[model samples]
Target chain A: MSGYIEAGYISVFSVLTLYGGSLIIRVRKTEKKLPDLTEEKKD
Target chain B: MSEVNFAAIPQVFSKRAETATKIIGVLALLSLIATVWLGLFVTPPDQFMGNLVRLLYVHPPIAWVMFVAYGVAFLSTLLYLWPRTRDLRFDRLAGASSEVGVIFTGLTLLSGSIWGRPTWGTWWTWDPLLTTTALLFVMYLGYLALRRLPGDPETRAKRSAIGGLVAFIDVPIVYFSVLWWKSLHQAPTVLDPVTGKTYIHGSMAYTLLLGFVAFTLLYVYFVAKRYRLERLKYLYDRVLLDEAIQERKREAADFKAYGADKKSLVPTAFAENGPALGDARFFGTEEESVVGGGEAGR
Candidate 1:
């Protein structure tokens, strides 16, 4: 019973955190290049 | 295509927009963590299902969020396609939401499987709920794939928009499958048409409701972040395209100039192979005799 409970909690945590982490990673990567991209627009 | 300079317009989310995104993300995470803590330790185990019931907090919320994401994608696609409000920004939104929606959908399946393994004695079954969900997942996955096809931006948007619209039909079917058919899955615990109230109450119901709210905020953050990324990739690709077109134009110009010179622009042939250069000039004597004799007789 505790195993089932733990699995459920672990799954929830892992999924939500992973999804959030993915968003943060994407935002950082894209943000890093944003200046160059906008500079292109100006040029 | 005619060559044009592609300036990558960076979709800078304004400072205000960035701030809002951060706040939403923080709030969502905080609420979700609170809900998990309450569910795991604070809430009592079910008399019948026992602690396995904890999945109710996470599973239903995830499923609801996935639906919300798909709904956003569908509406955005519709806006893009409608003549009154057609725009590539909406297309960007549609594609972005669809990608996040796919991720959520996949997680829904994964979570469902984990919960199912304990309750159903197997990780998966071809149940109506499960089957329709799997179908929905694949359809949106197809929508994401459609976004990657090579073409002019407008054409690609139109194609992907149409795909996003068509793939959305499965959403309703997935939602209703449990009701319309004999499903092994449980009926809705939150909706009660007969009693007109939720089947749950107390801290249990409270946590579930908060889960929905928290995950909705999470969904907003996910879509916002993903949208920024989509715009970034779009701009980068256009920048590369501009470089390619420019190179091609330059090569074409050089080739055109070379061809024009080949036709005797300032005839190097005379300078290189003439009587002055000590090479026998073709028809030189004939030219001299004809011209000289005519001038002498005159």
Candidate 2:
């Protein structure tokens, strides 16, 4: 019973953390691209 | 000297929204940690399903969040399809929501399967709830594929928008699936549609509510990030296109100007003889002259 409960918690945490981490990575990548995107378009 | 306007494009997301989402994200993480601790250690296990019922803290909220994501995608697609309000921003939003929705939906399916294995004595069954969920997943998988299909931006957006709208039909069907048909799956856990009440009580209810809040905040954060990514890519594409168009215009202008100044057009050559019997005059003003070889100086 305890094993099943622990497994469920682990699964939920893994999914949430991975999804949140991906979002953070993408936001940073896009931020870096912003200035270059503006400069290139203007050029 | 060619002006190809790139001024119409808008930022996919504002800096303020990004910062706000980051704050919400931090709060959401704390909320999730607290909720998990409450459900796992504080709350008592169910008398019927034992500790297996702890899975409830996570699964139902995932279903709710998945619905919200798909709903956002559907509404964005609808806005994009309407002529008066049509814009690429809506299409980008639709794409962002679909991406996040697909991941959450997949998680929901997995969580349900794990829960079922212990409670229902099987990992999966062709129950109404399970069948409909599987169908929804496949349909959105097709929708995401359409987004990446090879086409002009307008064509791709139209296809993906239409695909998203079509796939959204499965959402309502999934929601009503358990009610409209017989199934092993239980009815709504929280917010009973008939009695207008919650099925869970006390500490259980608090944990469930926490799950919903955390999942929703995560969804919003991901959607904003993904939308900005799409917008930056869109802007980069427009820049490349404008640069290419300007280069072509410059080449054409230079050719026309050089031809006029040097008397380099061989207009009489075409009438005197056809292409087969043509002299150097056909390609240039005279023998060995270059027709489109740019201004004569480097």
Best candidate (score: DockQ): 1
Residue B153 lDDT, candidate 1, scale 0-100: 89
- The C-alpha lDDT values of all candidates are 0.79, 0.79
> Across the candidates, what are chain A's individual TM-scores?
0.72, 0.74
For model 2, report DockQ.
0.38
How far residue B189's Cα lies from its native spot in candidate 2, in Å, is 1.5
Task: List model 1 lDDT by residue over B171-237, tens digit each.
Answer: 9999888878999888778985445677898999999999899888888888888887877777767
Question: B30-136 in candidate 2: lDDT tens per residue?
Answer: 88788788878888888788888888988888889889999999999999999998898899999999988888888888888888887888988999989989999
DockQ class, candidate 2: acceptable
Best by TM-score: 2
> How far out, in Å, is residue B61 in model 1?
0.2
- Candidate 2, A1-43: lDDT as tens digits: 5665677668867876787687768766755644433333445
